[model samples]
Target chain A: MAENPTPTPARPRDAAIGTGLGRVLLLVYGIFALSASARALVQISSHFSEAPLAYLLSGFAGLVYIAATVGLAIGGERGRILALVSCSIELLGVLVVGTLSIADAVAFPDDTVWSHYGSGYGYVPLVLPFIGLWWLWRNRPRP
Target chain B: MNGPLSLATIVVALVLGVWYVIRCALNKAPSNTDLWSMLGLGLLVVVLVVVAIVGLFGPDRPADWTTFVGYLITTIAFAPVGVYLARLEPTRWGLLILAVAALTLPVLVLRLQQIAEVTSG
Candidate 1:
């Protein structure tokens, strides 16, 4: 409305989330959730037999994304833990799968979300976990 | 998906992306004006999506029209979703939300173009 600006308030170490950085985190997570699921749907429905491993990885990626989204949206101590666990698993999954997809191309005839460290998606899958972890650390609750 | 409409939508979205990125870097809270501009962009996207809908009925329908239609829903709803989140956040992150949406629009538009190219009528 007015040019008047609201001084950015310090967020609760825990109470409310998705206000500042959490909002951006949510947006990114939302994007991943949508894209992973959409891509899996396309691959599995069209030609699952062509590359079952890759397509299944896509679906697994989608599930993790959904878990992360719910965890972030819930926003609490346990919520943060859920988000942390999911994001950490995501990081490891992407790295391991990403390396496998690249190092052993024959094993992956098709691509997953983490294929080649998510080069297809601008390396966002690779980068997202670090951001997620950072967000959680920043919002660590004061018990 | 194949007309001046989609092209314009991409160009305008990129421009808005640059604007939002700059705002985020500067740590500015999203202004009402920013929201209005986003709404304007949303209107443009609506126009492009509607045109694609009309194209769907025409003689050259894309194969797997279902996915294309699904993307159309995502594309049309994207900006308004960003605006709603941005409004709730009211900070630099809000600007970042706009930036993300603007960046995403081009991807969706490009996907629409690809799907439209594989026609079955």
Candidate 2:
């Protein structure tokens, strides 16, 4: 068989969603996933009754972060949808929970990742979803 | 966890983190020297984690020993993970990844120190 002389040109724009800058985002998301889930595990296992709502929220946030990380890692049409959903939920979660935690402090005796708009985490939790959404938008599949 | 060692690690990591960020901004991929420096930082982190682990055997132990151990594991693994990801990337973003990892180390180290200070023994 004769070899083709012309090779396919690389298309940076159409590269896998998890490459380049996406990989950097993946690392940050991975860290958050690990930390949030671990924190939830520790809190729920050690003293679930003390702050049931907060602990559950922590677990929920952890799941969201994990989903986002997986979505970024997968990086395709399906991955985009997954990341979009998770990031939206994260943004909403942070805002609603932040407000509730501040407005009704008694209900949230403990801090979740979103409490006080993630002030406890240097507000990274609050900022992360925005960045995730922006990245997703940037990597949207073109027609 | 020795205070001086933690301080040194944090200082070095922060300095390297800044440098990596600058390199990334300049659109530079991670050079061999850059990767090697990260490994060197990783070695420093390994030593820090080892000391912390050995501290666990001493009379005084962190009140939240489980969390401390978890952070120690994460801290030790962080640098190698950064290096691996950066190698796979081979782009400016790779340096940014290293920067993120480098910056996060100080936070982990500080948390470790805070946990260690609250010894129950």
Candidate 3:
């Protein structure tokens, strides 16, 4: 943490994934990772028969969030690609699940993280992927 | 639960959340006071969780005890985790880290209250 009187050189694009607002995204993703996984664990363990599909989806959502968090934390070319895929999946999952949960409530007897566009957890689930993708795109390497 | 301690923690967190976000928006790094305030919040959370634990042994224990405990762990860890990340970044984003953590603490407390309300009949 020594202060360098001279200006530091510009950092490479590899470190872009975790700079500026990307750090905020990382914290949010980490929160979702914990919440989604913990919720899935409770649902699957406590009453698996009640809503197996929903519980499994919750587990999947948790994994996606975990990947996104890791990808953002480890900023580099690999991390960018990892985050891109995870964000894309997150976006699709929320949209598909959100629409289906609304259209066919019977099928979604229980709620996953994406159910009803994440109404239970606020609309963050729906909005998070877009921000994540934008961050990834903004940080994409320019050759 | 809806205890005074929980209410206090939520209020303090929200107030600090607003302050931190504003600081970040103004492009200020998390200063020493800002970081210390976060640590103070963490200490308050510790007290709140400890009280909740004591309440768990009361006559009207929550039916979903496991979930309640899970939330307690999350709530307690929230602030310190933010502080750790904030220290690492040493920039405006560090303040945002505090802002996000502070914002999330209230939600965690509210969730804890909901879970605690479902007592065994």
Clashes of each: 0, 0, 0
| Residue B105 lDDT, candidate 3, scale 0-100 | 93
lDDT of 3 by residue, A54-114 (tens): 9999999999999988887776778888888999999999999999999999989999999
> How do the candidates rank by TM-score, highest first?
3, 2, 1
Tens digits of lDDT, candidate 1, A5-109: 877664344532536777677888989999999989988998899999889989999999988887877767677878888999999998999899889999999
Worst ten in a row by lDDT for model 1 chain A: A10-19
DockQ result, candidate 3: 0.67
Q: TM-score of the candidate numbered 1?
A: 0.87
- Candidate 2 vs candidate 3, lDDT winner: 2
Ranking by DockQ: 3, 2, 1
Q: Interface Cα RMSD per model, in Å?
A: 2.3, 6.0, 1.1
lDDT digits (tens) for residues A10-122 of candidate 2: 43442334367777787888889999999999999988999999999999999999999887677677777888899999999999999999999999999898999999787
Q: Could you tell me which 10 consecutive residues in candidate 3 chain B have the lowest summed lDDT?
A: B1-10
TM-score for each candidate, following the candidate numbering: 0.87, 0.91, 0.91
Docking class of 3: medium
Task: Choose 1 or 2, whichever is better by TM-score.
Answer: 2
What DockQ, between 0 and 1, does each candidate earn?
0.51, 0.59, 0.67
